[model samples]
Target: MDAVEHFVKFYKKLDNQSLTELALLYSDNIVFVDPVRKHQGLPAMRHYFAQLLQNVSTCTFDILQVDKADPTVTVTWVMHFNHPKLKSGKTVSVDGISQLVITNNKISYQRDYYDLGSMLYEHIPLIGSFIRYLKGRLAT
Candidate 1:
C-alpha cells in the first residue's frame, strides 16, 4: 500500500483497537505535530497515541474535505470521542485539519491543526472558570 492508504489504515485500526497495526504506519524518524505538542520519532508518537486512545470509549472520524498535492495530503475531519470523563460524559466532536507528508510509502511527517478553544478550553469547569476569570481581568 502507498503512504496515504497506510496512514488511513492506521487511523482505522486505531478505531478498532488494533493498536498493533500502528507499528507499521510511521517511519522511525517521523515527526508529529498537533495543537498540544510536537514529537519526533515513532516512540514518542506511540506514547502519545497510547494515552490518547485509551482515554476515550470510542472514536470515529468523519471527513469533511480532502485535498492532495503530490506527496502532501490535507484532510479536514471531525473526530468524535466519547469518554466518561468529559464534562458532558457524551460524544464530543473535535474538528481539525491534518497535513500528511508521505515519503517512500510511509508517513514521514504529520501536522494536525485544531483549535484549543474548541477541543479543550471550554470543556473543563474549573479551567474554564479560570480562563473566564483571566479574560475578564484583562478586558478591563
Candidate 2:
C-alpha cells in the first residue's frame, strides 16, 4: 500500500501496542504537530504516543474522508477514546483533521486540527458546565 493508505490503516487500529509500527509510517525526521504539542523526529513521536495512549483504556479512529494532492494528503476522522480522566472513562468522540506531507514514501510532516474544548476541557466537571453555559449563551 501507499504511504497515505498505510497511514490510514495504521491509525485505524492504533493503540499502545501498535506504536512500534510508527517508524514504518513516518520518516526519521518527521515533524508532528497537534492541538496538544509538537513532536520532532520519529523517536519523539513514539514517546508522545506512549504517554498519550498509556492511560487510555481504548482508542480508535473512524476515517471519514481523504483528500490527496501529489505529496500532500488531508484526512478527516473522528477519534473515539476512553480515558480514565475524561468522561469517567467512558468513550468520547472528537472530530479532527490531519494534514500530512509525504516524502521518500514516508510521512515527513503532519499537523492535526481539532477542538481542545471538545476533546478535553469540556470533559472536566466544572469546566464542562461553564463551557456548556457559554456555548448556550453564545447560541442565543
Candidate 3:
C-alpha cells in the first residue's frame, strides 16, 4: 500500500500497545511536530506517543479529507478522545490536520496543526471557564 494509506490504517488501529509498530510507518530519523512539542527520531516519537496515550481512556481519529502530491500528503481529521482528568471523562473532539512527507516508503516528516486550547485547556475545569470567558470577551 502507499504511505498515506498505510498511515491511515495504522492510526485507526493505534493505541498504547501498538506503539511499537511505529517503525513500520516512520523513518528512523523522522521529525514530528505538533502544537505542543517537537520530536526527532523514532525513539522520541515512540516516547511522545506513549506519554500522550498513557492516561487516555480512548482516542480515535475520524478522517475528513486527504490531499496528496507525490511525497507530501495532507490529512484533515477530527480526533476524539476521553480522559479521566479532562471534561469528567467525557469525550472531546478536536479538529486537526497532519502534513506528512513520505520518503523511502516511510514517513520522514510530520507536522500537526491544531488548537491546544480546544484540545486541552478548554477541557480543564477552572481553566476551561476562564478560557471560554476570555474567548467570548475577545469575540465581542
| Per-candidate count of clashing residue pairs (backbone under 3 Å) | 0, 0, 0
TM-score of 2: 0.96
Model 2 lDDT, full chain set: 0.92
lDDT of 2 by residue, 47-127 (tens): 988987887888889999999998999999999999999899999999999999999999999999999999998999999
State the lDDT at 82 in candidate 2: 96
**Winning model by lDDT:** 2
What would the per-residue lDDT of candidate 1 be over residues 63-119, giving only the tens digit for each residue?
777788978999888887777776577787888999988877778899999877656
lDDT of 3 by residue, 1-140 (tens): 87888888877755534887788889999999999889999999989988878879888888889999978999999888999999999999999999999999999999999999999999888999999999999999
Q: Tell me each candidate's TM-score.
A: 0.83, 0.96, 0.94
Q: In lDDT terms, how accurate is model 3?
A: 0.90
Evaluated against the true structure, the overall lDDT of model 1 is: 0.78
Score candidate 1 by TM-score against the native.
0.83
Candidate 3 weakest lDDT stretch, 10 residues: 11-20
Look at candidate 1 and tell me the lDDT of residue 25: 76
In candidate 1, residue 6 scores what lDDT?
64
> Which regions in candidate 2 have their CA more than 4 angstroms from the true location?
none
